[model samples]
Target: MKPLLATLFVVWLSACGAPEPATPMTQAEAVSIEEAWIRETPPGAKVSAGYMRLVNAADAPARLIGATLAEAARAEIHTMFMQDGMMRMRQLENGLEIPARGQAALKVGGDHLMLMGLNTALTSGAQLSLQLQFADGSSTNISVPVKPAMGAADSHAHH
Candidate 1:
């Protein structure tokens, strides 16, 4: 009987070893952003692009509604798509949504942020401060690193 009791005690200890569930963060802290970067602009360019990964850890969906930056006169969420065999870009005024426990990526040749009417040219190795606003009226301030496009030889001439 003593041996059986010891075995039960060991089983109970193993069950207790399981980790507890993580505490839910507030609405302001539910969104997690990572890998924020701004594309370097060519000389005299007035426009550029920024990219990042947005994760929603809350139980409800989160929307990235708007953005602000001192370096640009206006910032907008945009998406690039193929229409009639031509690439077209459009503003996403309604914003982008990330489902609960899911993520959305702002990437090249896809959904991204458009920084228009840049006050100055974006140079490599510079840090850009951006404020991202959500639909719930909560905002997150992030510092994005300026760098050339990764493994891409694209020019900002069209921008």
Candidate 2:
């Protein structure tokens, strides 16, 4: 009877030691950009900001290399960092990364798309076409509406 009990204990231990199931590897479905919008910057400003939600349904990580919009002469990835008690925006030369099965948000005072050389003011309710390039040699086109800049106090709001 003792030997039988030992055998059962060993079986239980083996069961407990089993490895967890592996995450399946599947082709990454093209990412989707939702609620894309350019903030309404003041007239004659050299820079404006854009924000959006990038959803990556794929099982692997992906990188967003660059973007383009008709309203801006150039688009770039930018990040805000606190330096010497001040928030400063800097261009991200390496681009943005979206984790597997996750999402990254481009919002104010964080990772955002910079719209440089704005030809016109981004008035509320105006829509613009933007193109996003990915690391996999694929790209996506999205239509984004212009909106008022989020107030300083309300910048943390998320969908």
Candidate 3:
């Protein structure tokens, strides 16, 4: 009955196999990301904006220092404001801060990510990767889905 005993031991070993452990999460990955999107622009538009809701759940504050994308020459943090009855945009120097346990919104008509020198049109449904750098020496890469411009309802599939 040696074969029978060997089979029983094999079954027991298989049944007692250890469960796979979960991978560790980084500090940047622990940050909350919500409603992240990029505006779809027409051909020759040259520029586009990205918006998102960022929440810092850590005990310390977080700062968004810069961003990088392959499709754009450069990206900058900007704030849109009304000045003298006219809308204007300005670069946010020294980065933007998100207080601990607080939220920072990069949305339309306010703070946003400005993409400049676009190599091609940002059509709706296109999937692109953007790397957001923070002051803590950590960065997170996000896959952003392109959405139609404001007031538009076209659903372009990602290529």
Q: Top model by TM-score, which number?
A: 1
Q: How far is candidate 2 from the true structure (C-alpha RMSD, Å)?
A: 10.9
Q: To one decimal, what is the Cα RMSD in angstroms of model 3 from the true structure?
A: 8.4
Model 2 C-alpha lDDT per residue in residues 67-100, reported as the tens digit of each score: 9888889999988877788667777898898888
Off by over 4 Å in 3: 1-27, 152-159
Clashing pairs in model 2?
A: none
Residue 139 C-alpha lDDT in model 3: 94
Clashing pairs in 1: none
**lDDT of candidates 1 onward, in order:** 0.87, 0.79, 0.82
lDDT of 1: 0.87
Off by over 4 Å in 1: 1-27, 153-158
Report model 2's TM-score to 2 decimal places.
0.75
TM-score of each: 0.80, 0.75, 0.76
- lDDT measured at residue 99 in model 3 versus the true structure, 0 to 100: 77
Per-residue C-alpha lDDT of model 1 across residues 1-119, encoded as one tens digit per residue: 99999999999998988798887565458999989999988887889989999998888889999999999999999988777886778889899998888999998778989999998
